[model samples]
Target: MLIYAHRGASADFPELTMAAYEGAVEQGADGFECDLRITKDEVPILWHNASMLERAGNRGLIAEMTYKEVSRAYPQVLTLDTFLDYAIANKKGVLLETKHPVFSGNRVEELLVTALHEKKALAKIAVSVMSFSWLAVEKMRRLDSTINTTFLMHKNTPWFQARFSSSAAIGPGMNELRAEPMIAKKIQSLGRSLNVWTVDKDADIHLCQKLGVDILITNKPAHAREVLGYP
Candidate 1:
């Protein structure tokens, strides 16, 4: 199974920062995962939450602030362009999670596709777009069918099998997989690869292995590599 650093070795370094992503690469992670949100200037940035108050102590929605304003408030924040450049340079795979409540219609999808095309990084590194919103998945597919898409599922989500038929993979929460081990097989039976998220425990790692998950997304990439017997 591929081990992707969730938020780039988030357990060891600040989440979504360049430090965190570089740390993951240093630790020998196969790939990295990041959450994305668009700024007021239509720039896609790496950030998990809608507000920057918790991480940067700035009190404003990311969508309400321009890239320049956000950079001034939080210099650590990384733009999607910067992150993609790093991933392409390092030849690392990236799982980009598009945060919901997007304020800019299809602008986020447009910008991301345009960036990938501009950099010509599509063939250089592996990239997958994942989201809780099925619309986001559809939008991404419409923009670039070649780019892989994953449908992210939480506990109470309804049956999404038909809704995400075009997705190349299915990302279920680790806890959700634990509750229904058969879900993994079910997803695989549909010919979709399984990518489980935020798994940190040894038992969970073993469970994912037994279920034959294609990718394991975790905050502790180095530790997970050790557990998985990877050097």
Candidate 2:
């Protein structure tokens, strides 16, 4: 099992800021998981919101603003390309989540794979297309099976099947894991990995490790590393 820094070391710095990502990479995180969303101009940026961009330093929706305007406003507008170039160069991994569920187009997967392919980092990264539609990930495999794509479950927990299933892995929330421990077992039995989200406490991390989760997404990567004895 490995630990992934969620939105970089977001517990200390502002979430999704470059400072947090750089710090997490410096701390030798197995990978950093960041959220991706396209702005109003269809320019993909490392943002988690589909409509909201308040924390992104503006009041308008990212989908309503062009990249030029968004960039001019928020100097920290992390692009998928920029993020991949930096993360892989530092020898860190990435578990990116595409934050475009309501939108049509499948633009999130397009930009993400394009950036990774351009950088030759797709082999080393895992992307989570967090849509109710599982076809999004299946569509990703149309590009590369070895390129990791996982289904991000929202509701109605599904059973796991290893070889027959098109998906390579699954990602559920911490709350989901607690409600149904069998989900963890089912995933492990299927020989696929399970990655849970947004946890920042030592006790929760310990339990996640105990449950044999393959990846733990956390805000405090350095602290989780310490507790998990990564060093």
Which candidate's TM-score is highest? Answer: 1
- Put down candidate 2 lDDT per residue, 22-51, tens digits, no spaces: 888776678888888887667778887664
Over 1-231, each residue of candidate 1 has an lDDT whose tens digit, in order, gives 999999998999999999999999998888989998899988899999889999999989999999999999999999998999999888899998888866777677788888889988778998899988878888899999999988998987776653446899999999999989999988998899899998999999999999999999999989998998997
TM-score of each: 0.97, 0.88
Off by over 4 Å in 1: 161-164
